[model samples]
Target: MAIDITVDHAVATLTDGTQLRTPFWRIDSDRDGHHLAMLAAQHGNEVQGIEVARRFADLCAEQLVAGTVTLVPYANLLAIRHRRHSSDLGPEQPGRESQGFNMQQAWPGDPDGNDIERVVYALDAKVIAHSDRLVDMHCWNHFWAAAVLARSDNGVAVQMAEATDLPFVMWRNSPAPEADIATSSHLMYSRGGVSMAIELSGQYQMREAEVDRGLRAMANVAKVLDMIPGEPEIIDGPMLEPLAGNDVVVEAPCSGIFMQSGLEPGQRVVQGLKLGHIVRDDDLETVVVRSPACGRLWKYGRHDMKCDVRLPDQHPYASEGDMLALIVQACGPERE
Candidate 1:
């Protein structure tokens, strides 16, 4: 028999005087063994995660038989509201970075710090401390809607990823040298809990396939936590294990009108294949973009003049030295 679940919403105030609200769905049953916290849209442009969180909130009302589930669909409220990646701290709170401080990097934030910091503090005090496991939904930059990557160091995180029954769990320990234990997931992991980050395709626009995959992964995560009833229905698939590291950023060699070769993430390519081109608008000369190695396409940024607007929203034009694409070397795995 199904159970009766109730939904509730809570609000919090940031030091910068930003008030944020979140929704929690509670299922009162004897199976209360774990607590799961999900954060979506840490980057405002990423919306597929929110859709996944919403679908889980709707289905888990009855599916969650044991523990409680807390879902914060929009972690950066001001960013999402303004349709920007960083928070709307305005001129007064100018961040360290030229554009602004990314919410993901300003973790363990100062109470008297900037707007994002206060918000992070609120989430840490209210959400991270109370959860047994955390699943953070995020999207890569405006690139090819690529394959999914599940990242974690803790066993519980790995278990949660397995429960999501994703085909292949790409465990990346080699983040950029700058990666550390300051982000929200890192906070949860440091406190002896498990946290996982799910990167589901490109940002700035919503993709239906990406949203469905995310929903399925979360459903499995709940099952792994024993917060929800039923066997995890992880669809069979191929998992991409990182060889060197997860992110292999390719930068544009020169500034020009970018043109693509119809290359996409998830497309397998051999070495020397032409990936894209840059045309000098003045001379009408085109340069060839080629693959340096043989691997699957993990991500590729699209251009405004190139990307198909038929998909609702196309990304902006690429600038010189911008992140052109990210390639996850598909090779051997299991290394610290």
Candidate 2:
């Protein structure tokens, strides 16, 4: 059966009189079922999800068996154009200075607000509000593995997260405070809809491997929603639960060049395991970085630096107290 496809733009005007237009694709099958909305590039540098959204729309045009699917490939046009986390166009609002004009933090935004907020408001009303389920795609540092982050208390969201077949799944049980309700996924979940965020590895530029993984995740999600055919393929991996206080973050003891100890993300480690070392640039002294607790390494790399682009050949430079690695506790099935 032929599917119906509609293409439209979410239009908003910036403070500088520039028209901010974001295009979205909506596909409807002959038989209606669930509505799944996929969004990417909420953080402009996270381009992997943009490819996933585009490819998934194309796939739905040909293989959609039931229901509706909406794709917003570039959810934040200003950020994507600048190739940064957010656009620098907005005036610095107090408490939001570091975030700039990030769209992910502007959920259900105000139409009369600043540039990013207006754009987010338009997108929220025109696309997100109408959808029953949402997948907000994002990217992390290259040193981290791809994973699905979802609310543990939401059964449907948890099922969707597991269906992605990713290497890891991180669950949060607490309800988001109204003031802290920043992400679109959280906004949708608050409205009693299923929502999850997929974090692909690497940002700024698209990696073929990461893009392929994202595509697979979208397909698996479609299968689970029955928008496409077949059943979701589940993979065996760690279902991580956040520690009570905070993650075991191994930080550099001194300002130096960081060297890894052959431990990669997703690797299990014991307490006091040596993760890496830092060679102090000032005194030529070596300081070892170690895991503070037994858990799976979630991320490992230099911290407190702007990672808007890929740095394949650049050596990781770290300062004292800069994060070197993050260890997240693995939880058993009992937690579920």
Candidate 3:
């Protein structure tokens, strides 16, 4: 099959002339049905999804070939340009402070709007307007791992997850009150296009293995969409969660250099279990950080704070109500 390729540029232009480019490539196949697009680096730091799109492009350009495939590698160039993964959640870097408004959050964007929203408007016009389904990739802050989130039962999203067979499936069991305007993923769904957010492992420091895994999975997803030929192997081990409605803050009871005695995410714990300890700077006594409930450790903060400092400031000590760790009750076997 002969594949046709095109690079369409958006109306928005950065100060550096870095226009948003959408690469549309496809080979005409008799069975071609669904139109598919995979977007990566909506948040610049989540590099694996972008890597996946790169590999999918290469594979389509070489081996498995069919259907229409639009790959938007590094959708948020400004964020990627600044080398920050997410623009919404964390503190901005010293020089790139203006890159707020999480790119993923801005959807069906405002053309004559703020920088981030303007970019979204351009993307909505240039790319999203032409696609039936999308896969938006994301990652956690520096210290956390990865997971996959999808609007459950949405046909395209369900098929996409089954195709990739990723590590976890975060089903939106209950929608957030602001689900309508919270992020681009939700906005995309509201606009009649099916979309899913895939989170990959590691952060800040990119790893080739994770990239390869993400790419391979995405390529497999394309095959599921009939955009490519040949079935790709499915990977297991995904932490499936019934969409969390709350951002439970596990704060530091007292502050210290959080000495987690080999504590890791996904580990089960009981109430009063000493998960870690906060050490005093001047060779003083250490305070043990214990679990508040009998549950499993699902997530934790990457940085430790002292007892004296306020949250997000990273003061080495802690005060009351400071976040420490997040624990969740286990359902059955761990997703694997």
Candidate 4:
């Protein structure tokens, strides 16, 4: 199969009168088929997906038999430059001080809006609008395992999620009431195209294991789409399907240093199992953190609060009400 690859940029002018050029690759085969848009690095810290997109593009250029693939390694250029989750320059709009400019939340953005908005607008028009399917790649903190998020109500989205061959698939409703933001995947799904978001494990730096897993997932997606040859591979482990709202998040009872129980993701536990402990920074008291429900451990971390990068990975500090662990009510697993 002959593949034609073209590299292009989606340009957007920032408020500072600087042009932000986001590079994307369009790889097309001689035979026309479905178009797949794979994007990554919406949050600057999540660099694993960016690597995945690059490797996937290279693989497609060599082996893709049909269809067109749009690969965006860095979807949020400013955020990646800043090395942060958002690119907001201190609330360009009034009365929105708390709402930091997150490109993922600013979908179908305004051409004449703020910096992030303008960038999203350019990308939506230049990339997303023309794709038949979209895979919004993302990364979470090191606490959770890799999972795919898909709209429970959309059959196409669910099928795409299943095709990823990831261990966990979280079923979410479109237009999530809690978030109330337009993500790139949500925008694509709303436009009658199949879309799903894959959350890779770890952030800040890329891991070879995670990158390989991401490549496998993307290859599976391509195979399922008939963009490449062969049937999607079936792994042996039972796949976990968890509903979005049916999980329990255990929070810190008091501010202290969190000492985890060394439990890994996918480990089953009964209700009230000891998950971790908090060593009070003030009084030196130890508070044990226990599971609130009977289920498998989904995610566990010190807290979401911003911390110094120099802090040791183990025994990180936590504040009161900060999430220490997440226990999902694991439904019976099903094989794809």
Candidate 5:
């Protein structure tokens, strides 16, 4: 269970004989500061965070001077290798159900719980329990980009969000979701530590610029925690004053191919703005999609304009109730 920050990378060898990702950690003798954990790929489809995790691990192994940092680059390997978003959809454990909405929410997991739950338990008890802060990196639902989130203590989340300069940083809520729904970031909050989730790029798509944004955001967190030697980096994107509640989501009204003919990502949107069109693949009947709030597109669903270019292996097809895009809201919850 010892993390040799010096270089041994492999953490666990699975029952099937495949070993888990190799992670490195460093412990500071000062003991006056906080322990930090960075995680990625908790959801198989969110690959952007894994790059952040890898980059930070190397940086900490070389530059970290105080406190501790553990980087888990591949938390859910099965989902990752298969390119799915949740372990529930993995081939090996098709019937396993504790994950709920992916490994992010299954916190303080049961030792006797299902496979992914046990993984969550090990991560929380062994890694997060010892930390004072955490950053769980995630990505967009479709081609749509994403925003950062702070859960647990909204006040502390504000501080964490400011540290990782990204688009708008909003507090999901102060009270943690009931334990059953507590995500990794909130679980850290429940344990009295501060945590933030940095969402960038996408669930199967990314722009180099977006990856850089996430990397810079993590470096900012390190600086904020004093885990690194510099001031936190500034995020130049339009920032929303932190607020509670999830970002406004415009759900798919019908199961059809989406066509983007209206507002695009990074563009200001007005309520009732033409969002797009949903052309049912079966019959070519089209349904118009519209905006529910005033904000910018963190991303325009790939279905909108680039559906033909989307690779099925990389992108999950969205259906009714699925969030096609998120608007970094412009006003009150009621207004949205």
Candidate 6:
């Protein structure tokens, strides 16, 4: 007989009286294993993570008769409901628009806090209290493609890394001096949980390839954790360190039009290599942009604007330096 499950859903009032709901399902099974919880959509722009959680919930309703899998498909509902980045933010909040604060950064949120902070803390309590394993999914900047993130040299995360078989896994937090840790994968790791941040690819559209990869990654995670019994295919790819604290951000020395050299995501590069060129005018005064280091291309400008340098939170277009690309010092397979 199928086991009966009990679900609990209610609004958790933060210290500020801003309430957030914790909707979870609990299944009692004969299987012996750890509790796993999947969370997504902490950021409004990174939507794929939320999609995966929704799909997994559906799959569980149909076939997950095993132990428990708690899901918070959309943790930042205020941002989602208003279609703003943060609940306190409005559409006209200067260049930032109405999107609220990035919820992921508001970890261990305050009881008396900003709308985003209160929400994050309330939900964090529920998920952290029950889960032994956690997976927080995200997507890349509209300009860059997808990639996975984990704490440097962690074994539990390694198992999930092997299962996904993704093309790259960024080790350690960003060493780049300008790197922002607020939205990093390290938050979950800091809490002493086995967690990995997944970048599913793209922000807006539901690309089938990305969707398939995410679903496969979820299944692989289950198998790796022994939540489900099976052998998952191992993925072979480059393991890279996020840029060092001394990493350079190639900015626009002079405003001009950006032209790409057809360098794709996850490509290779050498120090002094010609990355692309910028033109002061539509005329042929092309100024060459070269790589400052020896590594693989990690992130780059998209295919829309002319200037390579783009403002933070700006729309993706072929610009001069909107991270025209990220190049990492490539390394070998991680130890199992």
Give all candidates' CA lDDT scores: 0.66, 0.78, 0.62, 0.78, 0.65, 0.61
lDDT of prediction 1 = 0.66
What's the true lDDT of residue 15 in model 3? 39
The digit string of per-residue lDDT tens for model 2 on 49-141 reads 887887788889888998889899999888778767777633222223535477888888887888889999889888989889999999986
Which of 3 and 4 is ahead in TM-score? 4
Looking at candidate 4, the ten consecutive residues that score lowest on lDDT are: 89-98
Q: Ten consecutive residues with minimal summed lDDT in candidate 2?
A: 89-98
Relative to the true structure, candidate 6 reaches a TM of: 0.67
Report the error of model 2 at residue 264, Å. 5.5
Q: Which stretches of candidate 4 lie over 4 Å from their true place?
A: 89-100, 176-181, 243-296, 304-336
Error of 6 at 324 (Å): 3.7
Q: How far is candidate 3 from the true structure (C-alpha RMSD, Å)?
A: 5.8
Q: Tens digits of per-residue lDDT for model 4 on 219-302?
A: 889988888898877562345665557688888999988888888665666777788898998999999988877666677776
Tens-place lDDT digits, model 5, residues 1-336: 222454334344444555455354444425456788777877776787777666666666666666777777777776677677775564423223434636776776665655566667667666777788888887764455456877534666676687666656556666625545467766776667788777776666556666777778877777777767888767464566423343687787877666777554555677898888777756777777788887666656744443322345224345676566677676653243
Error of 6 at 244 (Å): 6.8
- Model 6, 70-95: lDDT tens digits are 77767778766765445555443421
Q: Model 1 compared with the native: what TM-score?
A: 0.69
Give the TM-score comparing model 5 with the true structure, all chains together: 0.68
Task: Give the higher-lDDT candidate: 1 or 6.
Answer: 1
Task: State the displacement of the C-alpha of residue 193, model 1, in Å, after optimal TM-score superposition.
Answer: 0.3
Candidates 4 and 6, the one with greater TM-score: 4
Q: In candidate 4, which residue pairs get closer than 3 Å at backbone N, Cα or C atoms, i.e. clash?
A: none
- Tens-place lDDT per residue, model 3, 101-123, is 67765677786666677788887
Candidate 3 has an lDDT of 0.62
